[model samples]
Target: MKDDSTEISARRRYFRYAVFSLTALLVMSLGMAIVPRQPPAPAETPFSERARAAALADALALRAAGQELAGAAAGDGGPGTDTALDRTVTLLTIQARALVLPGDTPTASAGTGPGHRTAQASSAGVPASPGNSATPGPASLSELATDLAASGATRLTDALEADGGMARLLAGAGAAQLLAAGEIAALAGVPAAELPGWQEPAGPSAQPSPARGCTSAGPSGGADGERVDPGTGAGLGAALTATLDAEHQAVYGYQAALTRLDPTAATQASSLLAEHLDLADEAETYAALQCTAIPPTPPGYVLDPAFLGAPAAGLARLESATLTAFGDVVALSAAPARGWAVSALVAAARRTANWGVDPGPVPGLTLDESQLPALPDRPENAALTASPAAT
Candidate 1:
């Protein structure tokens, strides 16, 4: 009986030991699954291979987002980076940090007296102190042009004088203006270049104020004379042609409206249609005079088939769309080429507005806030020379 008791105790002890081992094994597995070891923090990586890969991925994502914001996709530089240009811009950004001001107004030095003078109310206008003719501004574009020519100024300086030295001149005055306007663009606190970006202001500086340079002379009068260059005629003529093309397309679209909708519904639409046709004819006449071959209808220009009802209404819709489609072409065209296009667009827009169609105003046909083209520097640009005038 004592031996039997000893054997039972031994078996019991063995069983307890087995049970404990199993329990311990189970607990270890559970702990492992519930809380696995954490990966090392990424920042701890010191230029490791995996870290570099991660950094590159983040950079790519940022670049893609940036490209989208600029209205240009990642592949827009046409599949290759202009490395030299990129480097140049980077350098320029460094330099422009100084010596340049963004949108800085001229320092006002208490003009006149106690009361603030409106822009024109300066004391200088109160009869120049004695013999000085109010610092003698070049009274006319001609006088300014003469001054520029006499200085034998560089192309850039000539443009400044031509346009009244920022105190005057508007854009697209002439080649000199075009070049000069473009020259110092880089000097400004921005990515400057030879011509305006298709994307900023038309020039490096402010818009060239308008002037009637040499217009008083009849193509051959004299000191107050315009230079007559066939080139000028050609440019203007080209612009006229482009205007006509746009008008024709627009008119055709309006015609389509007449058939698709009720005549009564189109009465006002038809009137707008008539106006476009008249403007088109006028453009054609201008083209006839200059003899420049106008380009074909703007690339991808199409009739709006979707707007079959109420041509006038359809025009209202398509006007903005069409102007945008052609804007790039106008932006990229060379100076001489662009002059007429801009003028044509401006005139056509105005005429269309007068017809009560309201072609989105000048903004519809010009640079706007959303997308700015690079501004061009003033260089000698096309001017109305007398020789180019019709006899």
Candidate 2:
């Protein structure tokens, strides 16, 4: 009887142990089943990378439109259309090269001939406008003009989001696109009213006051205008000061040019002169706001003797020269300032065009065409070559 009792007690102990083990395992399994697993987070793209991709995408689309325009021009588009198309193509190609980052290879749709490829909407969330859809053949000149204008508008929007250097680049490219579009539209018989107008971005409520201890000297007469000291630092202040000085010089140049220009030309010069004076005042206000010391404007500026012989040409040269300063302002400033700078850039470029000089591919940023990245090795890009002016 004693041996039987011991065996029963040991069996009961073993049964309890097995039940505890099973319960523990079941609880662990339930816990695991009840909990959910989280997915790994995606890495965020950098602004620079995103900007470059967007710019390149826009450039490619512009180039495709340019190619279509080129074909149309070749086939009786209109007089001067060939020249306009050449410039348009050149601008698109240079902008594409500028947007290419180191180690990046731009790819286009394969098997499409020049003017045959459809423009892809920018991956930067820009939606395609009407008539931008892929077609069986080349797009009409009007359609191409619309695409260029749309792309230009997209670039301007992207500029607002880009860093300083990139903002300047995009602004210039955007201006180029608009200019090219206008030219092509004229050739295509599209009404000027039909082109989309670029709306300036909203500016700050009020210009900031100048810092303490900052002051300005009145205008002084000198053969060469007094150079404003671009403050100790390189920034918006410096850019504004430089632009102010450029405007002063421009005011002087326009005045001198007006003396030699024909009545018709003088009227335009006089109007532009007033605009330059206004710009000078605007720049001065901006500089003071930044606490930059304003130097006295020189009464006279050194002019090229050639300017006397060809005042109109000289004015174009003068206008072209001011672009860099305006571009600097665009790069260094925020809203209102940048908006002003962009308007200045576009106006200057248009003025240059009026004087019969083609503002090269990128207006503000001076680039060595030889150093720019070559177009990707693709069959469709064969006809897209940089123009002489681009160089």
In order, how many clashes per candidate? Answer: 48, 0
Best candidate according to lDDT: 2
For model 1, the superposed segments whose C-alpha errors exceed 4 Å read 1-103, 106-235, 261-265, 293-304, 309-313, 321-391
Give the root-mean-square deviation of each candidate in angstroms.
27.6, 8.1
In model 2, the Cα lDDT at residue 187 comes to 82
- Give per-model TM-scores: 0.31, 0.77
- Top candidate by TM-score: 2
Candidate 2 residue lDDT tens string, 121-173: 43344423222233335657776676677666666666666677887788788
lDDT of each: 0.34, 0.71
Q: Against the hidden true structure, what lDDT does model 1 obtain?
A: 0.34
